[model samples]
Target: MEIDFAEYQLSSQLRGHEDDARGICVCDNTGIATSSRDRTIRFWTLDESNKRDYTLSKILLGHTSFVGPLAWVQPNDEFPEGGIVSGGMDTLVLVWNLVTGEKIQTLKGHKLQVTGIALDGSDIVSTSVDCTLRRWRKGQQVEEWEAHKAAIQAIIRLPSGELVTGSSDMTLKLWKGKSCIQTFLGHTDTIRGLAVMPGLGILSASHDGSIRLWTLSGELLMEMVGHTSIVYSVDAHSSGLIVSSSEDCFAKIWKDGVCVQSIEHPGCVWDAKFLENGDIVTACSDGIVRIWTTCHDKVADAVELDSFASQLSQYKCSRKRVGGLKLEDLPGLEALQIAGTSEGQTKVVREGDNGVAYSWNMSEQKWDKIGEVVDGPDDNMKHPVLDGVQYDYVFDVDIGDGQPIRKLPCNRSDNPYDVADKWLIKENLPLSFREQIVEFILQNTGQKNFTPDPSFRDPYTGSSAYIPGAPSKSSGVSKPTYKHIPKGPLCRLDVTSGVSPFQRLLGERHSFSFSAECNRHDFSVLCVLVRRNSSDWSASSGFDVIPVTGELT
Candidate 1:
């Protein structure tokens, strides 16, 4: 098979996930499903009345943590529409009924994040960061083994019924049940993705920024090298096109082991897969799933096509204030010629079109580069004043049952979970109501990213903080009184944060994240969705509390 088009263009942008979109499963041409760090899976189907348009069909909410890999099973007697196998950071592999959006079974055993998933006939095969692979038959664990010494990150079933797994050990093993038939070694770093190349051999993507093709007998075939950062995923299309996503913020299309097209994203491209029609679907860190098509008629319309360009221009034109200073008015390199009045003094200098921050080093007698300056959200806008203090929002929360309304103060940049936790602690409310309150805040504020922590304290209750997945003492978990079992200490979440609203959370604590994402406007998108950028905003200090049942959901 061969590709007929010379170039590809943006077809559509699917937006719904509240956090990073992590995995994508294309169900032939029927539909597409994606999992996210937001702890949910969304199914999208083509709107046939409108070509190339996909509409959300269902939302699966079972994973308690970041959902990773997804495998699609064609329609069978067991599942009339189809079936889906999903693995998540919660260490659970779930089988789902695609039509009703219900969990068919929960297969558990892995003690860590479940990374890769594949279907073995009627059974489910899963690999985990815990360094093990397990097979589930009819919802029961039938086989389990350590597939690698390091974390097993990728897995795929071959046509012959044997399984292949890639791992952080930098090796891929061809397995027949518990036996390792052959070991293919070429990746110099962690293997992140694996795909079956139809009648050809196997394909693997790695953290070494390369994609490798390997024969079944442990022989290397072709090495595709173009990605400058970690390649997160790879998929083979029937057209012999290989699509790969990377931390470099690109989804690259390859033909005959050569780079053909590079699609740039606003954030890290986590996963990319091929549709049966040769279109590409990519999951990105910006919490968006975008489609790319070579069909010119299917390309995105003008408004959608200019979105990124519009955002870039808006950032550049509104550079009056960057990190609390008028960055556009900053001095040039000549400002660095004079000695600083004090040690460790910081200064911003204009270098071409960028404002670079530098700090004075008295001992070294030279300025050290700090970082590039970025723009702020809105300088003229007024924040709500509460008790002589300013805040982005002050929400009114009613916990039901005739409870008096309490104030929930928040900044646009504040994590809703954090604010809700602290307000619950202060109001002496049930810590279990934390998620509900967070949802309320998100809905009212039009914000999305809601990263929750593992544990939170009630403070008033004086009980040990309960972890999300741990069996709580209140649940009447049986205690054997074996003191030697060594239960881990309760995690005490610190609610205090005095950092600037302009500052950003380090990317997964990654040491070498892309510098482009640090742009002032880009980082500010975390607080508010920038796609529909708005400035006609006001800070209201009050909210109307809505009544609700005391359900945990």
Candidate 2:
């Protein structure tokens, strides 16, 4: 009863039939069957993966032109027989046992092509080009009624055991038992499809490019504009969503009188049906079937993909405008300066004069120092001095633009004129002072000074030479090579109700080579080998990003 919809974007579509598929049905166990104009019925079994695998189970040969319609009968406790009854342009109805793939019986009575069909209890009802309705009861013709004026295009039975038929004469007739009950005459064009939703009443589509809703008493409820061209089929979901396919090359979803989502197809969407998962399946005129998922939320999340492009497009519409109120400065924050008196403490004051006084709390947002800011010397003292030298040189060095090297011990230079000449070389002096000097030199000189040639000193400061380098790139690290994994041939693989395996042997064998080429600038190809019966694809191939090697590049 859960109605969460899952989505699948088709990587490739299989050309199902040489001609259009006119009839489609899904079984109680979720198996699919489609009858095409190629005079063959194709059967497909579903798996958790939703992989495409269909087998030509049986080629029903009684139809001369093509199979017209099909209805699958569910098995009852009294009779465990599950079967499918089909009508054809050959004026015959064939019942085939779905479990055994055998044609149980052929019911023949219609003089012309059988165009539409439906099921009621164990009986199969059919409408034909001969302007008559025929009912077949277990391979025998039990009832025949003169159903309509012209050819009956579509038909359905009501829950009250009455028959409803649409015709080319622009009228829909309701029949009770063998007698005609009522005739509805509002359509100005030929009726093509019919659907009946109880309480919501009857839904019908026509060549008039309209879908009209009517009550059971033949009263017009609503006439909806469905498509630009003729509408072919319509299906209603229990959630009040309606799916309609048309010759306009699209299928559309409508709910509560508003068009929600429109799905564009390569060809005309001839038929559309809502699946059990709330997703929609559409059969196209080009013999390809597609599934679609639509959301009822505000501005579909998928549309966010083009948000940047949409912003750029909007920018072109109006000229730019700007407005702002600029503020000068916060009172205490103006003269904020960090003076490291002791390790983590800094002195802050509201004056430009430099003086290392007692520490201020730099962690606090205010610039209030612990001691008062001395504007001038004390009256009695001749030498009222700052505690330490305020050196600005160290912070001025730009350590950002540097050639990254693995941390190594710094070797003291033997040259007396080197910048290390300023060091006291005393015990208990931190080793970090030497490391800082080496880092400063590397940041200034870059890779040019480190090239293997001699006399590569800094042009600005020739005091020292650059350190030796490592190999340029990390491409030698772990990498996998995909060599000639053959492009597979386009052949249909029949998958039954079990695990199916299809493998393509590659031209070269792969090894666990750890050499890789990393390119963060461009996307690399990722290969995933999925096991046949995995519930989630990540269960088998848990998202591993394999960096390609020089061979793939």
Candidate 3:
């Protein structure tokens, strides 16, 4: 089915997180839990009276670091209302009772950060940066095994009861229980997100700025390349609609490998998910949780059209009028004298010592230049002075004379031939003059032959074409190798010199400049300046700089 993007609108913006809202998962039909880098998970419930409004039901806390992943378990006989599982940078996985607002269990085993989590049949599977996948049951580790060569970022259980994990090693691995059965390869960068498409395939989002759909046996089916930046998260609905969030500040909906709709955000979209009712929820680095849904009424459609019209109205046509003097508008036009008959004759107008002339062609019914005319009437004059230049000939023509010169001014040179060639090419002279000027230049410059050299051969099939160049040995100059320095406190001045800590950890090299001002006596007040150079990046990479002042002490 063709989905109309214009029908979608932002239903509400949930604002409570102090930092980036990193992950989101639907708890039930009317409830969703959003985890943030602020080390908290917030529960939101849809108001039945107003579908656009979401009430903050509870704020679950316990994780001491950035919460990155979340999964909701279905209600069973053991837990009547179900619970939520969260993985965080604190190297801990916490299971929370959603209705009671209580932490049930804290599963700990991985040495590093927990990156992703998923709910299996009565078991919880979690992947970590420590390169291991651990399965937990009843608040205890059941089975653990190394999953990837690098850190695992995302994990999901397919409808067929098989588990799939995506890792920073640029590959996705399929596992039965704790053993990997097959590995899928195609992405050139880290795989950040994964989602199952039921009977279709598995969708994987990557840092390579592309999303790929693969079969269960690890065959790459198709690739989706709409996002210009790293894709962070992907979620699929039962209706075959896929929603993906990216660092490109956009959340796009895909259907049958085509992007059908896009929701733009002001900051990097960290996570996006589809609710049970087909609504979309996106968490962004701007510390805001936004929900988008299609309305049934014409009022919402009118509002959406108005917004689109306003966006389209931002572009307009710009016009500029050129004004200048033409050669025919100059004084002494009537002073010129005709030398021959008007039918097949040459017209010569003398001014000072040089003459402005034109030759009449009877067949073409047009005037052409004989050779080159200077600003003098004397034909015997060897060197005529014009525009502070001593030229043997200067051609005066009326073509494009009435229009303002669009060509830029250049420095005057002693060689008239070079200046003439530049001017002729710049003005786009007629084909007749073009051939004549080429011939004149060749004749004046002197050439041995007009034919191609007999010794030359086509490079494609030549014998020497396959010859390899001499391999060079390495020079004594040693290339600089950057060491992985553990990030210290933000108070260190050296931390501001190179890339930021976040970029360094992500292995991203960005070029930017920053400045700051602080008072010694009043350590509480400070100001910072940041300038991002995005010309080397994509067009959407440019950002507006806003001044911020706050207490820092």
Candidate 4:
């Protein structure tokens, strides 16, 4: 299917886990179960107020270690109300009655940590770090056998009733009843994830950062490589799409061996599963269970509006740290009011007598004023102030468009020449404009320089500039300097007696010509000159060396 993967947005975030969420599974149409390193399993249901959002229904606590895998039992005669089974690092598998929030059974036998579990018909099959696979029926071990030489990381049963297990030994073994049928070998590292793709084949994800497709009989079909770190989980939907989560902090959707969509996570994604409606739920190391879906209707307009408000609040908090005015601090502000228009736009207003309104601008990615300027010229004009000082006739200019505008402060009562020079240095104005603009501001302000600073530092580049009549510490070197030179026009040096001809032929040659202005700075410059032939110089590349307090113009 041609799905617009880009249309997939975060539908909701399930926040309850106290530690890393290790596994996630869709229990039914509206329910999801997540296991965590916090030693608890959380049950969440679609929020009735907003179906896109999930609220914690219950927390099932019993496991003493990290709960890593979970499987749902289909409702049958044996499990009339159908429960969930979880395996974890404590080497214990616990079966829980989902409705009652009670542990129904604790199936134990593994000598080490249980890594994975799967439901085969009415029986539960689990793999462990003890390098063994055990079959249990109704809380009792029915059968057990050696599955791998090393820890078996994952296991799944095929539609043909054959069991397949992947291990740290870097091989997958297909088992029929108690005898091994075929072993598929390709991964160079531990196989961390396994899934059965119905009519397609078996898909295996490994610590080698690769996913391999194989037939039921053990023939490798295709190798998918994209993740830079270990892949932890792989799950397939009935729609012929496969999703894999990895330690690379992303979950990827693959179709016919091609990765179609990638969902980025803030932390390592431990598990991802598709819900009944094809919505995806991911478990992450950030202790968040996030849902991503192409279904936009899942998230109601009100919920999305609240999310936008939350983002704006976070932005306001960030602005407070950077010394910017808040919306409440605006002119005639009382309470901040926001509304959504019918045209899918957001409008925000400062509620008061002289309140201002702003409309969301999607194109500019910011809020734009809604009404025309009504204030008179005198009211619209604003003087620049900085550090308790104001500058006359100096207006603030917004150099960073769409970003917070910064004010340039200077002493207004001070000599105009002195303030202008300091402001030019602080604003990092070009050296070429120092004479014209400084003199113009001084003449207009009608002030004379009583005391002028001779040495000033450029704020942006941190470069020091010295005035013409300034005293210098050394002769001919008034300030730190930087020079950019073109290294070209190659000339072959004569090979001396002790010099090897082969060395001269293989060595690179470049000549440096320094100007009389070079002795001002203490720095080093390394240049590389490439020659296409003995006489033809192809290209040259180099960089200028500047002092720590100096910058190149």
Candidate 5:
């Protein structure tokens, strides 16, 4: 399917615990971790479709205190298999193997409650309420740093062998080991979170509802003000994107100090991070994590809630505002696609093959249509094909910029005349080419049983590309991974406005190359042959394919 990135949709929700949730982490593998005020941790797998796609993967006991912070140990270039590391008010940091639910070695040294933890390689760092920071090496207590005079809320390691800590004392401190290197004091309230951009120094969030950019030498570089409420969590992306979750119940993204996107929730946002694809993932107090993409020329240019603006730098500018609206009950809404009729009605398309199209009236009431394309022929005939399709050359021609498209020679599946093929055309093919393309698809595609469902639309890209495997029920699989597509000749149509969805299947979706000629208004269909069941191509090792040298009608 050709996904339209113009809108966002809600995926499956991870539900189990019932108390106010604090932190959420969508693991690189496995499932998601949700921590609640109920003093419990719940894991939701993607592969199950039950009342709650979650199980008590591990009910981390031993914390005499409520869980305050959680972080998933991502697979490093050093270690592909990852684990989970969590911290609680008990002042303890525990590492657990996600696969086997086995607790790794525990390091104990913090006198007060542990607030947060950060891990890199075999080195681990923790901040605590006792106003101290400790670093632990693989199998030993490496060092401790008394860098803060008050409770240390957050800490981040910089590339310059320095560590930056944010504290409730309204200041950010840079540290080396047991010694403080520099102190940045500017925020009017408590410093809540800190994020480092590697070579770009550090960014800190504060209860003053602003973020400050501080140099490692204690110099204040830039002050960002937008959050209407206290900023609790701050995460920095390598692509100059900084995300902050606040009590304002929103997660905002800033690009070099200018607010770009804001995602709102029903509850306070506790944590947010920019994914590898420039998308933001935020955890809210409502027991949900939201995912938002960065689309240009959209509502992404809006400034964050400017509750307290006096301390902000002059670089803050208000630009055009576009999207970023809160859709209720959809916590982790990530990917969005929009499709509609040529009338340009104000209707949003949600994912699913429901065989129906719903539009909202002025009052936002659903006005349902039988399907996306409704007014066509009945179960029998008596319909019109929007695209110009010749019955005989139906499957051979792809809707193009113009008509009279040519066809190429290709081998069809073995069972070309199977009953399935006949049923597919009768149901899927437009009345104009029902009989013709039905025969052509059978002749060339080699699928004798190829029957087009009235509800079936050929996939937009690639060939032999089947749907991905669903999540396993017990394995707690949550994310969908891309499947391999075999090399093959694929066909596509570039129908102009008012064209039908199923113009015809003239060629394969994936191929090596092709050329065509047609007029501006004349839609020409194009097709290419693909190698069947080809192996996947890799960066180090490419694959050979059976290249089709000719064209198709």
Candidate 6:
């Protein structure tokens, strides 16, 4: 079905957050409410003189770390002007009085960052990176349980009062009260964003670079593709219009699962939303919140539009530069025939005197042209140096034209996801770029098909290449150091990080490569025991395959 709406145009930019805006909520009547990495929640109100403009009204601070998720409540006796609920990296959920902008309650229990929040009447439901869901009533914990085996990243409540949770496990679960009734599985990566389509179903945006529509019954209705990178957030308007934002620096609008418009930005778009009146609002990594409107009267003037266009052009100009690279040695465009392991994975092909960059759109199974490739291009040294640290790769990240070039150091022994997360936090960059930076590290470092460490998941990455006998990170308990004892004599063996006595998987997420070259008897008996919290796993290792026979203490 075609969306019968006017084309969205730039309306106005709202600025106040000291850092990148991460969340936006337009449900309140006072104005727009947004959460940011600045550890503050800001409220905006419309200007009486310039009706299309919004001015800062209030700033609420309570969380000690970056705030991300938001929820709104209607006015009641407890909150005369409605209320605002927010979650943050401080692992606390706060409820604020919309009118006074004062924190009314602070709920604490999560051991990790809170990823999602929803208001259930007078109760508040929240999901966290701790892989659990907690419910609170009257500012007191009412119920809590393990929601997923991995970190829960997104959550939404259906009109029928059922709850849906999306997790780093690459799956969505439908819940009623506290029981999971259905599980939706299709996304190959972390599920980051969730929203209801009202009459249609539910919509999910994922790190897999695709948006999916699924019925409550667990049937995938449609998979929408077009964003060339990690999709951070998605929203739906009652008119059946869907809008999504991505690390690709584009806010794409989709109608019937087909991309109808792509609104470009100078930096990553962290979140997007639709107002009841059909206007669109986008929170961006550039420390600006932009409002797009289909109504001509609300659009910005000619001079403002031109200024935005010039800024976008300037960004593209500085984003890519051919440097220290020989064109003849570059891979041709035919190199795109083989699929990339992840979405937004960049590939540079030799194009005449320059090497053009292309981003893999996994959902479309095609490569989309990004600008020219940048960085060292090809630093094939034994080890790259960054700030006195030797690394397998060091990537130069171009955030903007005037900013200093940021160096992202990576070692083959390090997990790309962990590296990206730490770098983003250290540099105070938007958290939405975690997946994008991971892809960049994987592409430039040539670490494809890397296994992900399931233990410490903050919105998971990598493939399902599990190393046998490795401890699951989500267990939340201490892991036992397992040793392999052979019946013969003890031999000195080279040991790396994860390498056990004889042979073991070294790195956390790296591929396990074991070479057993000891004096082989006709048959050798290998006993492996892993004990933790009164549970034990015993395995028999043979030439054929290591199989877990039973449990022992």
Ten-residue stretch with the least lDDT total in model 3: 316-325
lDDT of 5 by residue, 343-398 (tens): 32332222231122234343433343423422233332121111211111222355
What is candidate 6's CA lDDT for residue 412? Answer: 82
Which structure is stronger by lDDT: 3 or 4?
A: 4
With a 3 Å backbone cut-off (N, CA, C), the pairs that clash in candidate 1 are none
> What local distance difference test score does each model get?
0.76, 0.55, 0.67, 0.68, 0.54, 0.76
TM-score of model 1 (CA atoms): 0.61
lDDT value, residue 496 of candidate 1: 28
The alpha-carbon deviation from the true structure for residue 311 of candidate 2, after best TM-score superposition, in angstroms, is 30
Q: Which pairs clash in the backbone of model 2?
A: 477-515, 477-516, 478-514, 478-515, 478-516, 479-515, 479-516
Estimate the overall C-alpha local distance difference test score of candidate 6. Answer: 0.76
Candidate 4 lDDT over 42-75, as tens digits, reads: 9998878767788898899999999998998866
What global local distance difference test value does model 1 have? Answer: 0.76
lDDT of 2 by residue, 211-316 (tens): 8888888899887785899888777777777778898866777666556677766566677766665566666666765545443331223443254235334432
Ranking according to lDDT, highest score first: 6, 1, 4, 3, 2, 5
lDDT of 4: 0.68
- The better-scoring model by TM-score among 3 and 5 is 3
How far in Å is the alpha carbon of 499 misplaced in model 4? Answer: 68
lDDT of 1 by residue, 1-553 (tens): 5645478898999989999999999887669999999999999999888787789999999999999999998998988899888999999999899878999899989999999998888888999999999989999999999889999999999999999999999999999988999999888999999998877889999999999998899888899999999999999987889999999888999998888899878778999998888889999987989999988989989998899556435445344454544444567788778776558767777676676778889988888888987656654424432332235676555444555656677877766656765675466443444545655666666664443333543333333333334354555533222112112211122222332222233111212222232322223222232211223333563332312222231
TM-score of each: 0.61, 0.50, 0.55, 0.55, 0.48, 0.61
Over 4 Å off, model 4: 1-6, 299-553
Give one digit per residue, the lDDT tens place, for model 3 in 297-330: 3123456546534432321101110111112222
- After TM-score superposition, what is the CA distance of residue 476 in candidate 1 from its true location, in Å? 63
Model 5, position 405, has a per-residue lDDT of 41
